[model samples]
Target: MCGKRIDHAEWRLTKSIVDIERLRAVAAKHNVKIPDDEEDYYRHLLNGLDATAQQVADLPEYEDPRLQIEPETLPRQWFKQKPNPLNGWSHRAEIKLPSPKDKRLDNRTVAFKDNVSIGGVPLTGGTTPEILTGKSEYPVPKIDAVVVKRVLEAAGTVSGSANCEHLSMSPLSFTSFTGPIHNPWARGYTTGGSSSGCAALVGINQVKEWRKRHGLPPIDEELGEGVDMAIGGDQGGSIRLPSAYAGIYGMKPTHGLVPYSGILSLFPMIDHTGPMTTNLEDLATLLGVVAGYDGIDPRCTPETPLREKVPDYSAQLASFKQTKQAAGEWTTSAAGKGLRIGVITESLAVPNLSPEIFKVIQEAISQFESIGASVSHISIPEHLLGPSIWTIATRAGIASLGMRNMPPPLLCYPCPDITPPALSQSSFDILDRHNPASANMVFNATLLQERPDGASLAAKAMMHVHELRAAYDRALTEVDVLITPVITRMHSQHPSLDAKVEDKMKPAIGSTLNTCQFNVTGHPALSMPAGWGKAEDGDAKMPVAMQIIGKRFDEESVIKAAAAWEVGGLGLDKWDGR
Candidate 1:
């Protein structure tokens, strides 16, 4: 009777022999009915009790323990998470010489971004599932990407590939599906990316297991006791952003300064690959190995040399050290004399900027003023200030080309005929809410349209492009270099999983606003780590970065200015765990 419900008639029959007599008395007081027939009444009572017990057991409080614990603390006995396809060896193999007479790069170990293909290693490009399935296909590359072949020939050995932004699309390292690129300076904050892995390996300590396998020294040993450098690519700040976040020096070089063949293409018009490293000398040395013109890359000019035949970067390093040693005292009037620095007002006016970043920029200007350099705030044309229509046009062109060129099976994965199930599902989700016929109607209209023969839309777009380039050239007239924040906002605080695509996109658009336009206009730009600031995590300080933009092909001038900043004691002293 324990406050249970049962049918009535059976209770009276069961009263003569069983505990139903007590049950009936309780039920009668509550005006409840019980089933008839002694056995039937008893069975009904049991069923009622069983049903109540089942409901209680089904309550949230009685659910499985596995779902209740934090993922980090979950038992190892549970199934392990899938290993990231993008992970690879962190150190380089010793370069075995073809002959004793062949020159070597003095035992320097070079690691390449995963997107760059090495003969046998998996080129995952962060999340190209096709590579993992043994079904991946690539046309016979006409030649090693000019940079890859050049680096190898220069006595650099390929270490294992490093992770990158998925498809190298985003500037934030965390957007990488393999893992968030951890900041070497601070463990909790993000390493700037799509060159995330390239920065991480150079910036942070390598895993002990990898060090043992490659017979290479640990990161602490390498940075503190030896030297190592990372070579990576940039499209819209990939190389520069990571270098800034990792607190290292990086150079994007002039557009087409390094050949782009055999590298994964993001936007060819804006993409440039270059070096990332802790020391300026290391960057110079690495760049010397990889920079060259390749006939395969249409953008590469034959005039560009494979290596700048300078006396040695060590000499430049020594000079920089000497300058730092001079402190506030100037040895000569030439110190910063005639140096013109322009601050782009449009870059500063972008919204959501952390006050600390602004402070760093202001402090840098004061430093320049303390010396003999002239600093002024300048405005770029409103239309040319941020990334413009060209950005979208280039990206669309690349994507369309990639899709059209992909092998039939690769394009239609998981179905190989018709559209892929996975792809169709995702596509329909975007199309479902809209009228299905609208897409076809728009396509047909565009196909059927006729317009005036001359002064066509394409011609108009070309004119706009020229106008923008002219505007940028004019803006640089009064300034030796334009200065702007590396990113509009501070580095994100949460782990990679917490960030959304839009979160990465917003900052990328802002940061690349000042950098990418230069690429379209064929100017050179360098991003230097200016300082650091408190991250949202309140544990590690994220890097504060600034960009120095120079006129087209003026790589040497941009390099010299960046050198000045590094020599001026603006570079980070240590990025080891903040």
Candidate 2:
């Protein structure tokens, strides 16, 4: 084993690595000193620690299931200075690993968020090596994320990595190492992030495809090639917020529905990664390919179905679309005949929600009603407190586990590519320069760690999650889907790189007001673009989205509702003031 193995009793007797100074330093930090009589007693007790650690250290590395990628899945190339024009691509996926045996994602090109590992590819988590280590280097992962394997197994071609917000922190774009990710709908503004580039690429693809289908010309030549779908991560509102701003569909499936193994996590409890696509059909299909219990992440419980048993979400949505139209009625109330929609009364009360954006969502609801779905205001008072609960429950844990890369409280896969040296002033400055939101989270954690009641406060907030979930459950009992707006405003322009932290972080404040609740409640939430809204700073019209949330593991209803509203009602890619 590690060095020569000695007798079991000898470990306790050996000097090992714990020296007198080391023990003294630890004691001083706590304002304590070992009595002279007990010095050797304590020293010997601590000396055995290194020997015990060596035993585990000498053990073989874990055989990660993510490493079982089939042949032909080798990665291609990574980009340097100039990223794709939209600043979307982190690399080019010249490698095509197709499974002729599969159909769900046959020939679809899919990009994984930079934080999700793709074997032999650099896992950026949206920062250069110089940001963390003062060297231009990045960790190339040897394993593919569980979702990557599943996507390939389903016949999807890997379309390389997409730029994400630095360390997957910000809810709005402009925090990426490469640069800002332009919103496809409004070039100089944001494509909300840390799933930033994923949304940008998918949004562009959606627009181009929609135009081509209508016999219109291509939007531009800037979008070189294309991606049909993207697998994006979400801890707070990364996926949904970006999708909302970019005018596409993004889903955060029930917490455990999609195995999160091999992806960087912000907090083990809230970690999620799901599909973002141009349309609901692709979203449903890609989600099915990546979902189900992988027997790795502990988040997946006994209730999680086996991979083979996962529901055929795309097929089910198609069936519902056909079933509704089979009635042969084109009247005002034919499409959404049996759907029940709930508007979260508290969601509309968010402090900064603009009247114009409010009207966009209101009109979306009316459109649902016009297509025959019954709508009512459903109140969950706890929703007002959701963002607060999410913060207190997750901040310290995210600081200790997410930012610092420490071991978590549960058994789950941790993407080893992310190894931070430790939390220090230098590291904090580097992180803050990239994304102030992340720095704020770390500071909150630091403050909490010093308070005696911090752990208990977090625990109590976690307990309240059950109350919040039950409240939503009660609301859902009265309706099939619960809907809310994704954000209070349209995407904003990126601040100068050297801008003040407060100024840089301004756009992200309250950005997650309506999205983070479900992250903690473990519900399936999707952001569906309802219409367009005028940009606050420009003549450009930005995409507006309304969220659709469903009961845990009931993604079928969530997808079906959105699809009906899309295909059977007002249809996708709608315009403002329509």
Candidate 3:
């Protein structure tokens, strides 16, 4: 076939599969009877099949220095007994590196979400039992993730790994194998995940109290002091949700702005990793350090190329302030001057929205208006259908792909060799056994087998994702950015430690009703604390947040808008005044 001679090995493989049970079953379904003597038929197919396999296997590997580069990392012994105030750190270290030259992030202290590989540190993604015990069965990655390396190269000190949802598959912090991540604001309340610990650590929530409770030295608190920033991975609101609950700034930059080369991925298309910070400046600086192509992730496109030098994201802030300065309106009251902000009607009107949360967002909008921004209501009806589209695509399509040794949306890190703690036949089953940490994700893969027409249903759902993305793009044309509630309601209490898996999952689903849409659309979305609202019992107050979504790859606008909101002091009253 095609002038290539069929060799003995190819012929043997074909002969072995000639009477494979699957072939017979497929033939029966198609009503095409194969002769019992099928040697000739099998021989005819071997040449072409073998050639195709060889061609794929021989495809050249992607070449890049970042892929080959291995930076110096802290020894594993350093991570075992480091401080873990707030239960945020999965591994703690004081690893510091020098940049080749002057850089914007010089001297910054940053912690990474557990899924971002940090060489010798255990990457549990907050699920693996060995990681929880501070002992790992898997070999530590020799090279750090591209973003992690970039951060160190920019002269940033890596504090350690932050705990996250089990395998980063759930939105509730309690699902982490290490235990529930307590909200800094309210001890028993949730921190909103899967970037749960990143936000808590950045917020500096509970650290001093946690230390005091553990009989450690008190933090040297001073005015305007705390951790600088944190890097978080977002695949459907992981970064933004946790930041929203913690009352900090978090960004999910356009999908390909940062490489996904060294991180665990649910589906590559919806995957993103970005910055979470207490202030706008660190958020801008961190994004500058990590945002760009590294030539390894297939998700990066030419439109979002990795730059040879980092852009000054803070310039976007300077421009906004300069315009206000020119008009003699540079004060905090003039923060949002000349900006156009749209309140998304569909997002705010979500079912079961708390009235206190509604009031908090309304106050935030008024703060924007007072700062000279023109605010209006806008409707993108299709956004209400985001949850449905996410379910079909992630559960039906993405889960199924993982089952057959494939990950969808192209370009994902190969699943590693960690044994799953569970005992299911899911496509995502990586372990020899079963683990409950991945149960929510693994079980979804069985949708194909559970339903007779599951494959067709998933296919249709992916088509809807495209349509939904287009709808968001169209709405963005009408406004500079659209604002929505980060979550439909305020953060809830953590699930009981003894809660059943199904019970834990019950509060987890649908929490991303507003934030997940941008993951599908591949747009830049930022979450900033808006204000505080009383809890359900009216005894405790918690942070409320608003999300700002901009056009694809337009991270500057999202950052600038959030900066203005922060400067206006709409949400600062709730801050502990650090």
lDDT of 3 by residue, 54-164 (tens): 787798544345643344443433354334545777777677663434466777788889887776676776665442222355445545788888887888888778888
- TM-scores for all candidates? 0.66, 0.94, 0.83
- Give the winner by TM-score: 2 or 3: 2
By TM-score, highest first, what's the ranking?
2, 3, 1
lDDT of 2: 0.82
What's model 1's TM-score? 0.66
Please tell me which model should have the higher lDDT, number 1 or number 2: 2
lDDT of each: 0.56, 0.82, 0.72
Q: How well does candidate 3 match the true structure in TM-score terms?
A: 0.83
lDDT of 1 by residue, 537-571 (tens): 46556767787888766655565556655544553
State model 3's lDDT: 0.72
Candidate 2: where are CA atoms >4 Å away?
A: 1-13, 58-60, 74-83, 98-100, 130-136, 213-217, 329-332, 567-573, 576-578
> lDDT tens digits, residues 1-578, model 2?
34565565775566547777888887899999999777765666666666778788898667575455566664356544243678888876645564445867776889889988887777788876754434468887777889888887777888789989988989988998788888876678988988998998898888787668667777666655558899999988999999999888899999999998888878888989999998877888898888899988888988889989999998898788677667753345667778899999999999899776798899899888887888899888999999999999999988888875666878876776466555567666766787777778777898998899988999999999999999999999999999999978776888888999888988788899999999999999999888877776767777789999999999999987787676434434465232
TM-score: model 2 vs. ground truth: 0.94
Error of 1 at 474 (Å): 2.9
lDDT of 1: 0.56
Candidate 1, which segments miss by more than 4 Å at Cα? 1-104, 131-143, 205-227, 302-334, 382-384, 402-462, 494-509, 574-578
